[model samples]
Target: MTFLSGWGRTAPTPATLVAPRTAPELSALIAGASSRGLIARGLGRAYGDAAQNAGGVVVDVAGMEARWSLDPDTGVVTATAGMSLHDLMLALVPRGWFVPVTPGTRHVTLGGAVAADVHGKNHHVDSSFGAHLRSLTLVTADGTSRVLGPGDELFWATVGGMGLTGLITEVSFACVPVETSRVRVDVERTRDLDHTLEVMTATDDRYRYTVAWIDLLARGSRMGRSVLTRGDHARRDELPAGADPLAFAPSSRLPAPPWAPNGLLNGLTVRAFNEAWYAKSRERRVIQDLAPFFHPLDFVDGWNRVYGSRGFVQYQFVVPFGEEGTLRRVVSRLSAEGVVSFLTVLKRFGPGTPGMLSFPMPGWTLALDIPAGQTGLAGLLREFDEWVAGAGGRLYLAKDARMRAELLPVMYPRLAEWRKIRESVDPGEVFRSDLARRLSL
Candidate 1:
């Protein structure tokens, strides 16, 4: 038996972990473990119990690494489920190609990304990860492999299904073209909630990627103040003369000290940091390397340790279109309550994919990273869930750790349809995670 946990390191559990090097091995393992529960695990980047199963078999898909061919003419690349976006970008970016969608971190595996149906800063212009998936090769519970495409209901079910339907063995998707691995950015600082919304509404469409970092500790006149960062893929001409187009120098990484006090990130410290951060950023345009622009936090390895041993919880929720008021109200409540959130992000999403349980919608979405030990944190989030559901919004299952089961249906209205499809493919629920049990998925 092997012990495993998620990035949050909150609930460590032991399970019989099997690393199947091939698709056939994966199928046999699933078929053999029909009575006992089983779940597929990728890079274990999910922040909660989504990847952990207690007293069950855990299949580590990271070992099934077999890179397939890429059709240059069609701009489609087929690869095994184990591949990470970081590796894929390294292979494709030099050829003037980029991923269609990428989350904030590149450490996530292809299978995990598809199962989570991740979204990025460009969700307003593009969509979730499921939108770019042309097809997938799934290993069903009965030890059979099948190909599923856009029109197939099983494909949509597996997308954002939390790996409950089946094990994804292979994935095929289209890639976007890029001139260089850099971004041409336009950044601005907003005075308050109204100003932030006004600026985003006025100019978000001009850039391919857009996101805002809000100061959650601010209040009164300064409530909801943020720094808006907008950018497009940098063209070759946008770089300085003689810059190497294909060269990507690895950025220096700073490690967080092993032992940081729990009280290090209190409200006073966070408020002061927010003030200095806001003051430092006025409106300006700059060209930055892709690493810093997309994955700034990545420059600090193991930075999650900054929160200490208890870890943190990331609350990401999307409110429906024309419900910006709901977003404003939630931010205001958090600010008034003095919740210390280090990073609060705001983005606008376009239409979602066909995945019944997918997270994105045509609306405004906000995500915050909050320490877990804060008083009444769980109760406060539960109360916010009601507001989110009332506004026809839903929480991102990939980032969720403590949402209640009763709220699942309210958050995902199409859960019934998704359940039907999942049962059709995996009637006995052979694929199960702690998250599925927690939410009764």
Candidate 2:
């Protein structure tokens, strides 16, 4: 048995960890799982318990031999679900192609991406990962590997199902064509949340991608000051003279310190960082590499360790477009409570896919990283959950380490249907995780 936790480093648990090298080996394990059940894990970046199950067997697919192919003409890719976006990008970028969707980080695996139905900065233009997923190969509790397409109900179930229905072994999806590795970005500094939202709503459509880095700790007139960064893949002419626009080489990374104080990211330090960041990100336009624009934190190895041994919790929630009042109230409450969050992201989401458990909708989504040690953090967030549920909004399960089970049905009205669908394929309930057990999912 080995200990495990998600990328956020919360809710540590022990499980029998096994790596299966072949489909038959993985199938056999799933078919003979113990009462605690088993779930598949990849790259361990769900930021929560979606990949962890106490006392159960955890199957890591990294050892599973895999292969992938990319069609330059169509920008379509066929690959095993265990393949990470980092690997996929390394292969595709040089060939003038890029993943159709990417989250704040590129270390996540194809399986995790599908399970979470992740949305990126470009959600307003491209939608979540599920919208681009053409099909997937899932290994069910019955030990059957079935190919499911968009027309199949089972495919939608697996899209944002958090692996409860079964383990995903392979996936085929569409990639986007990129003329250059750099992005032409425009930066704007908003004095407050209201102005930020107004500008984003009015101008976000002009760009293919848009996101704001919020200073959640800012109070008074600047209660929610933010730096909005909007852009799309740069064109060839946008690049400087003689530059290799297709070069996929990202900047070098600096390793995080071996160890830091448990409260290293407390309010004071975080406030200073946020202040400096906002000051540095004045209104401007520039060209930046895809790496910095899409996944800046990935440049720093083991960056999560900065939160110290106790780890941190990533809270991400979305409220519908008309629920701007609720959004303002939540931000006000967070600011009033003096809760400190290092990196708070705000983005606008477009129409969503048909995935029953998918997190995003036509709304505004906010994601923040808070140290778990914050006093009364749980209760505060629970209250925010009530506000979100009341507004008919929902939280992102992939980033939720702590949320009430009762709110699941309220936030996700289709929970019962998803559960029904899950039980149909997993009659024996052979696939489970700590997240499933927590909310009785």
Candidate 3:
């Protein structure tokens, strides 16, 4: 047994870790799992305990047959779930293709992507990752592999199901064609949250991707001030002379120090960082490579260590449209509390996919990265959870580490339906995780 924790570095638990290199091996391991049950793990990018199963088994899918082949004619690619988006981008971007959806980071595996049903800055247009999936092979609790598509209820359940429905063996999806890796980005600083939302609602249709970096620690008139960056993939003609349009290379500038004292990212430091980030983007309509625009943090490997060994808590919640008041209230509360959330992002979500428990909807979603070591942090978040639930908002399961159980049904109204479908396929409930146990999912 070995200890494992999520990217947040909280709640370390010991589990029997097994890496199966082939589908058959994984199937056999699942069939012979011990009473502790099992769950699948990918790049461990989730900020919570979704991947870790205490005293249970964790089958690392990274070793699966992850080779991928693309059909340029149809823009479709098939590969095992273990393949990382980082690898996929390197291979596909150079060939004038891009993943249909990508989160802020590219280190996640295809399985994790499907399970989380992750959304990106383009969610207002492209929807979540599960929406682009053509078909997938699911290994159920009975150790049977079934090829599934959109029509199957089991398929929908597995998507955003946090891997509790089954272990994904293979995935086939459609990739979008891009002319060049460079994105023509337009950036501006918003005076406050209302102005930011107004600008996004009025003109977001002009761009394919939009995201706002919010300064949560700001108070008074600037409480929810943000920097909005919107852009779409630049055409080959937009590039300067002699530049390689399809050139794809992402280099890490440096890794975060191996260690830092807990509480390193307090109000004072995070306030300074947020101010600097906002000030540095005074220039508008800048051209940047996809890495810098979409995955800027990727430039610093192991950057999570900057939050210190205690790690941090990521609270991501969404309130549907017409609930802007609730959104404002939450922002005000966070600001009043002086919460040191360094990378709080606010975005507008579009229509959601059929993943029953998928996080996004037509709404406003805010993601906050707060230091877990902060005093009274859990209580403050719990209070916020109640407020969010009351406002008909839901939290993201992929990033949840310490949410209460009762809110699951309150937030995800389809919980009962999802459980029914999941039980039909996993009668024994062989596939489980700490998250499933915590929320009683």
Tens digits of per-residue lDDT for model 3 on 239-357? 99999999999985687898988878888888899888888978489889999898989888898888888898999999999999989988998899898887999999999998999
**Candidate 1: worst 10 consecutive residues by lDDT?**
244-253
Off by over 4 Å in 3: none
Q: Summarize candidate 1's per-residue lDDT along 143-244 as a digit string, tens digits.
A: 778999999999999899888888898899998888998889998999899899898988989989999999999889989989999999999998899998
Q: Model 2 reaches what TM-score against the true structure?
A: 0.99
Consecutive 10-residue window with the lowest summed lDDT within model 3:
278-287
Question: How displaced is residue 16 in candidate 3, in Å?
Answer: 0.4
lDDT by residue (1-441, candidate 2, tens digit) is 899999899888999999999888998898789999999999898999999989999999866786899877888899998889998898999999999999999988999899999989889999999999888999998988899999998899888999888999999999999999999999999999999999999999999999999999999999989999999899999998999989998777889998877999988899989889998998899999999999999999899999999899999999999999999998999998999888899999999999999999999999989988889998999888999999989999998888889999999998888989988999988998999999889
Residue 348, candidate 2: Cα error in Å is 0.5
Candidate 2 has an lDDT of: 0.92
Model 1 C-alpha RMSD vs. true structure (Å) is 1.4
Candidate 3, residue 253: the lDDT equals: 60
